[model samples]
Target: MILNGIITGLIMGGILSLPVLGVAVIYGITGIPNFAIGVIGVFGGFLTWYFLSFNMGIAILVGVVFCFAIGYIIQRILLTPISERGGDSTLFFIVTVSLGFVFEGLMRAIFPRPSISLALPRIGTINIAGVTVEGFKIFALLFALGTLVIIRLLEEHTEIGKSWQATSQNLKLAKLIGIKTNRVFSIASGIGCALACVGAIFWGSLYNLNLMTGWDLGFLGFIIAVVGGIGNIWGGIISALIMGMVMSFSGYLLGGMWQSVILYFIVILVLIVAPKGILGSERSL
Candidate 1:
């Protein structure tokens, strides 16, 4: 039973890490706590379901495009103006939170039903070590790890990624050095949204889709970001895995309701011990 719980938690942690990484990326670059991250993900899942009849690949592609567009639009139309007016981080945070609520309402209107299920094409199950795991769960983990590797490679080898790193390090200096900070922000937002879309698809495959799914993911992602150290993508991933283990153990030993209680308690203890998170830097927002 313990081993089973651990395996399940690890799989779930992989899926949950997707959105948390997205949040970390956006926060690292733009210093905005994008509360609407999950909403964008939920929207993508809905798009996948809407277009599932055509082709799964096409559905996923459309969802990614839609999420990218939404993120870009939000950054360009709303966030840009606010930033130009000298909005602080607090203001940016409030704006994002408000946007999250607005998007949630829009989602509720579009998906008025209580719940909907959109299962991925099953690849059956596989036995690993003595435990049986769903094939889709393996796919989701590999997909997430692959995506992270790609992002890391881009950050190391690409001019665009270098610019992002520079901007993240010092926005004023980046602007002075002729790096188009606004464009970088927009691109970061798009990339984050794309990641969120991927997470949404994987999550939708595992469970029923509902309006609240986005909120749940976004909130949890936020916690994971804080726990992993906001603006540290790798830290977020590691923290997510740790959280998964804790959640799994707590759920197994105690009860389902106690899972969150224990998780939050651990987070508080971590914060008290290391306010900057396990791998977080002093500059982490």
Candidate 2:
């Protein structure tokens, strides 16, 4: 039972890490709290489901592309104008939050009915040390990791990645150095939303999905980011795993209701003791 719990926790953590990392990356790069990330993810999942009649891979690809476009357009149309006007972070943050609701409403309108469980195509289950594991869970974990690796590689080897790093480190300095800050912001935001889509794919495969699916997950992702150190991708990933383990164990031992209570407790404890998070710096918040 313990081993099963651990493995399940890891799987859940891996599933969750994508969105947490996305939130971290966007926050790190733009200093804007993208409250709409999860809703975007929800939209992606719904898009995939809508197109499931076609090839699954193609459906996923389309979903990803759609999310990327959404992110890019939002940044280009709304955020860019606001930022250029010297809007405060608080205002931008509220706008992002409002964007989440807007996406949620859009999703609700598009997917009027609750969907049946949309499981991804999978082989079969595997038994490891007397514990039965879903084959798709392993695939989902690998896919998530692969997505992260791809992002890391892009950041390391691509010009866009360099621009992202520069903008993240110092946006004004990046602009001064002739970096196209607006373009970099749009690309980064697009990538972040794409990451959220990846997360939504795995999540939708694992559970019953609905328009509201992203709400709680978004909140959880935010918590994971804060606990792991906001704006730290690696930190968010590690912290998500830890939180996944804790949530799994708590759900098993206490109950579903207690899981949120315990998680919130951990968040409070972490904030009081180490507000910067496990891997975050003094300026992380």
Candidate 3:
């Protein structure tokens, strides 16, 4: 049972890391808190489910591409202009909340069903010290870790990554040096939402996706990101794993009802003690 809990926690944390990365990446690069990413991701999940009858790979691609487009379009048309107009974090918060609502409505109207479970192929199970775990779950965890490594490499070696770092460090300086800051913001936001969509796909395959799951995911991801140190990618991953353990243990000991309550209470305490976060936002994205 103990081993099971540990594995479960890691899997959960791995799935959650995607959205946490989404929040970290977006906030890191654009300084915008996009509360809508989760909902848009769910919207993409529904799209994948809708197109599942055609082909699995294509459906998944459609979902991810659709989300990327949505994120890109929204950032380009809506958020960037507001940022240019000096919109603060508080304003972005409110705007993104509204955007979430809009996407949620779209999901409801278009999908018809309020809940769905994706039927992804299962890759059997693995036994470790007499504790059996699904192979896909392990894959999810490894995928999460691998993605972080890829992102780190991208930001370190690629031209786009260099531009993202420069723009994030100093927008005016980046713009003066011939970087298209707005385009960078849009692409960053697109990638963030795309990551969230992938998380949603994993979640839907593992359990279920519902109309309200997006809010839960978005809020929880944000909480983990904040506790890990908002805008800090590595910190976000650490925070996600710890919180995943907390949630797993609490759910086992207390019950599902109290799982999130405990997390929120701890988050409050963490914030009170360290106003910034555990790692204090050192190294955004």
Q: Against the correct fold, how does model 2 do in TM-score?
A: 0.94
**lDDT per residue as tens, model 3, 36-55:** 99998888999999999899
Model 1 error, position 159 (Å) = 0.9
Kindly list the per-residue Cα lDDT of model 2 for residues 1-80, writing each as its tens digit: 89988998899999898888778877877777788888898788888888888888998899899999998889888887
Off by over 4 Å in 2: 281-285
lDDT of 1 by residue, 1-285 (tens): 878888878878888888987898888888777888898888888888888889989988999999988888898888877877889878877888788888778777876465777767999999988899989888888887787788888888999888988888998999999999998889888888888888888888897778888888888887888888888878888888889888888988998899999999999999899788888843322
Q: Considering lDDT, where higher is better, how would the candidates rank from best to worst?
A: 3, 1, 2
Ranking by TM-score: 3, 1, 2
| Overall lDDT per candidate, in order of appearance | 0.84, 0.83, 0.92
Residue 47 lDDT in candidate 3: 97
**Could you estimate the TM-score for every candidate?**
0.95, 0.94, 0.98
Quote the RMSD, in angstroms, for model 1.
1.7
- List where candidate 1 sits over 4 angstroms from the true fold: 282-285
